[model samples]
Target: MSENPYSYVESELPRLLGNSSVSGVYKNKPEDFEVIEVLGFSPEVVEKGQQHWLRIRKVGVNTAAIEKQLSRALKIHPRDIGYSGMKDRMAVTEQWFSVQLPALQSMDWPAWFAEHMHAEVFPGGQVTLLEAVRSHRKLRRGVHKANHFRLRLKAVENADDLTQRVQQLVAGGAVANYFGPQRFGKHGDNVGQAMRMIQGEFQVRDRKLRSILLSSVRSFLFNQYLAQRIQSNLPYVNEGDVLILEGSQSYFTVSADDKDIVERVQSGDVHVSGPMFGEAPSPAKGRPAELEQHVLDQFPALYEGLCAARMGHERRPLWLRISDLALTWPEETVAELSFTLPAGAFATSVLAELGQFTEGEHANSTE
Candidate 1:
C-alpha cells in the first residue's frame, strides 16, 4: 500500500487572524455547546398523513443512535428515519427528524416516543420531544436553512486577546470555510480509507459510508486548495474565478477586467468559489485555476477515483459569513460566543480564527 497523499493536519492551515497566544477549552459539558437547527421552510401540516415530523432536543447523543431507537419503538425500517444532517453526539442540540408510516394511518407518536424514548430511559443520552406535526413529506438532508450556535470557552488563557481576535473576524464578516475536523473523521482515517478504496484494497457496499469516504476526498482537496490560496495571499476573486451569487447556487466564471464583479464581491452579493472536485473540469481560470491544479496534481488517486465514481462538479464558497456574532465574558477565565452560520458551515471554523481550543470528551463534533 502507498502512503496517503492527503494527511489532514489542522495546524498546517493558516488562520486568517494569524496565530494567537490565547488558548481555551470547549465542550467541557453538554451545555457548553448548543446548536439549534433552522429549517428553510415549515413542513406542511395535515390532520392525518403518512409522514410524521418531530422536533427533538437531545443531550450527549448521536443522531443516528436516536434514529435506531425510534426505529425499534416504531417498528419501521431503518431507512425510514430521516434527518437533515448529523448533530454532534457531545453537544446539546435540537434538530428535526421525519419517520414515514402508512399513509393516513396514525398512532399517538408523541406519547409513544415519550414513554419509550424519554431522556431518563434512553440508553446513551437524553432525548426530549419538543414538537410533533404530521406532514405529507418526509424530512430530507440539507433542508435546514442554518444552525445557531452558543459556545462557552472555558479556562481561557487570555480573554482580552481572544476578544480582539473576535473583533477582527467580525470586522471582516467572514472566515475561511474549512471543513471542520469532524468531516475527516478521527485523525483523517476517512481520507486514508478513501485512498485504500481507490487502490482496490477494499470495497464499500454501504451507500452512506461510501458517500462519506468520497466527500472526505473532495473536502480534503478543497482544504488543500484553500490553504494554498491563503498562503499565497490570493484575493477572494481573481481573473478566471468562479463567483456564486448570494442566496443561490448559480455561479459563473469571471475575468479580471470585470470591474463590477469586485464591487459585488465586496458587497457580499457574490462569493469566490472553490472546486468540490468531480468529473467535470474545474470552472476556474487564470491564477485560481493554476493554484487548484497544483493542489490536484499532488493527489492523483483521489482525483481519479472521484471522477471514476462519477461525483458531480460542485463549488463551495471560499468565505463563510458570520452573522450576529457576539462575545461576552462570563467569568475571569471564561468567554462565550454566539453566532449563526448558514447551512453546511461549521462554527468551529469561526473559533479557529480566535485561539487554540481543546475539546472535552465528545465535544469536538458539530451538529
Candidate 2:
C-alpha cells in the first residue's frame, strides 16, 4: 500500500486555514492538559438504587487502572464497574464511572472510599473521587455527548499567525477527523501486528488486545481513504458517494449529478463518508466506491482477513466540526486552547492543524 498506517503526515490533509511553522511544547505537565467528559444523559433518580455513579477527577492514571482500584476498594469484581469512555492518563481528566451495588449490600461509599481510596492512597496521587450519586443505570461506553478540552501550548512561536490560522479553521466549520496516533499501539506497531495476524504469520490470543488490533487495522484503512479524499480536494464528494446527515447515523447514496446532494454537502448539512472496511462490499457506488476499492485493493491480505473475520461495515464522516473553539494567550510564549468535540474524536487531530509540536510522553499512552 502507498500509505504508511504507522505514521501520520499532517501535510497530507488540506488545512482549511493555510499552514504555519509555529511550534510549541505540549503537555509539559499533567495539569496543563485537561478534559471533561460531557455525558449527554441525565442520571435518573432511583428511590432505592442498585447502582452508584461516580464523577471522578484523575491524573496520571488510566481508566482501567482506576476501575481496578475501585474494584479493590469496594470488594467488587472489576467487571461490575463501568465507564462511558477511556481517558488519557497523562492529562487531568474528569469522567463518570458506575458501580453495581445491591441495596442490601450497600456500604457507606463516601466514607469507605474517603478512607481507603483517597488520593494519598494511590501512588503519585493519581486518582481522586470527586462526587458520588445514585443512578438507575450504568454508564456505558460511547454514551458521552462529547469531550471538552483545555490544552496549554508552551514556548509557542508566531502567536499572531497561529491565531489567524485557528480562526480560519473555526470559520471553515470542519477539520480532518483523522484517527490520532493513540489508536495505534506503541510506535504504531499495532498495524504491522494486525497485518501479520491477517497473513497468518501471527496470532493474538488475548481477546481485548486482539480487538484493539483489529480496530487499528480498520482505522488505518479509514485514514487511508480520508487522506485520499483530502489530497484529491474534490468538493468532498464524487458521483455515487455515500452521504451521512450531520449529527445522525442515517445515510444515503447519491450521485454527483444530484444537485440537492451537492447543495447539502456544500452547506454543511451533510458529509461525505468513507468506508470502514468489512466482510461485504461497500454500500457506496460509482466513483466513490471505485476510490475506496482502489485503496483496499492495495492491501489484499488485510481485505481478505477482515472479510474472513466477519467484520461488519460502517462509515465515518470525512470531516469534523469544532464547536466553541477559543484560543487565548496566557503569556507571550504560551497559548491555551479550549474546544469541544464529539465523543470518539481526538484532540490531537485538531492540534495537528494548528502547529507542529513535540508530543508529550503521555500523548500516545492512552488506550
Candidate 3:
C-alpha cells in the first residue's frame, strides 16, 4: 500500500474494521467541513395511481420512526414500509417508501409522516400514498436517484484558479473522475485491511461478514483505479477523452473524444469507467482490472460514475455530478451538522472540493 494503515494493532491480532476502528469515520471540525441537503416531496393525496412512493429528506433512520409513530393510531412493522434506498443519518434527505394502505384512503398522510419522521416537506405535495398498483419485479438495489449535493470548501487558496479550471472543464464538459479521499484512510488502513481479508491474508472468525468486507475492498480499489485515471488528467484525453470500459478482465476502450459519447457519459447516460475487480487486486496494481465482464455489462452508467469520481477526487471539482453526498462545514461556531450520503460516492469528496482542510490535532479527525 502507498499509505499507512489506520487500524489499531490489537496486540497484533488484526481484525476487519468497523465504525469503531475508523477515527471520526465522519469528519468533524467546522473548518474542514461542507453541508449538502437532500429534499424530496410527494403529492398531497393517496390518489389511486400506479406510483407507490413517498419521498423524504432523510434516510437510514428506519421505517419504524415514521411507521411506528403512525402506528400510534395503527399497528405494523416499519419494514412493512418498503423503502427504495437507505440514506444518510446526518443529512436532510428525501426518498420514497411503500405503504400497504391499499384498502384505506386518507387525506391526513402528510401530518402523519412529518410529525413521525420529523422531516420537513420540500416539494411535490405531501406523503402521497398511491392508491393504485403496478406489476413489476420486486425492488432491487440502486433503483432510485441518489441525493443531489450542494457543497462549500474551507481553506481555499487560489479560488480564481480553481474556479477557472472548473468553469473551463464544465464549458468543455470534462472533469477527472476519481475516487474521493474516503477510499484511503488518512493513510491506507481501510484498503490494507480489506485487502488482507480478501486475499486470506488474515485469519477471519466470520466467513460471511469477511466475504462482504472483502467485496467492499474490491469496490474500493476499482474506485482507486478510476481515481488514478482522473489524477492523470485522462478524462479529457487528446481528441477528447477516453472511456476505458472493462468487462471481466478484458477492456474495451471507448473513445470519448467524440462529443456524443462525451455527452452521454457526462449527462448520466453512461457513468465513467474504471477497473472491474473479478478477484482481489495485487497491492502493486491496486487490484485494478480484475473486474468481471458480465457484471460490468449490467451497470453501463457505473463506468461514467467512476470517471466523475476520478475527476471529482483529483481536481476536487465544485459543480457536482454525483447524485448523493453527506457533508459538514462551518455553518456556525461550535456547531457541527451531519447528514446521509447515498451509495456510489463519497462525502469527503464534497469536503475536498469545498476547501482544503488540514487534518486537525484531534485523534478522531486524523482518519
- Models 1 onward score TM values of 0.95, 0.92, 0.49
Determine which window of 10 residues in candidate 3 has minimal summed lDDT: 14-23
lDDT of 2 by residue, 159-202 (tens): 88788878876786577888887787766677788888888897
Show where candidate 1 strays beyond 4 Å. Answer: 1-5, 362-367
Regions more than 4 Å wrong, model 3: 1-52, 59-81, 99-108, 118-140, 154-157, 181-193, 199-212, 230-272, 279-343, 350-367
lDDT of 2: 0.80
Q: Pick the candidate with the highest lDDT.
A: 1
- lDDT tens readout by residue for model 3, 214-257: 43444554544444444444333223222333112222234433
Which has the greatest TM-score? 1
Kindly list the per-residue Cα lDDT of model 1 for residues 200-242, writing each as its tens digit: 9999998989999999999999998888888998776788989
Better model by lDDT, 1 or 3? 1
Q: Write the number of the candidate with greater TM-score, choosing between 1 and 3.
A: 1
Residue 252's lDDT within candidate 2 is: 86
Better of 1 and 2 by lDDT: 1
Query: Could you tell me which 10 consecutive residues in candidate 2 have the lowest summed lDDT?
Result: 9-18
Clashes of each: 0, 0, 47
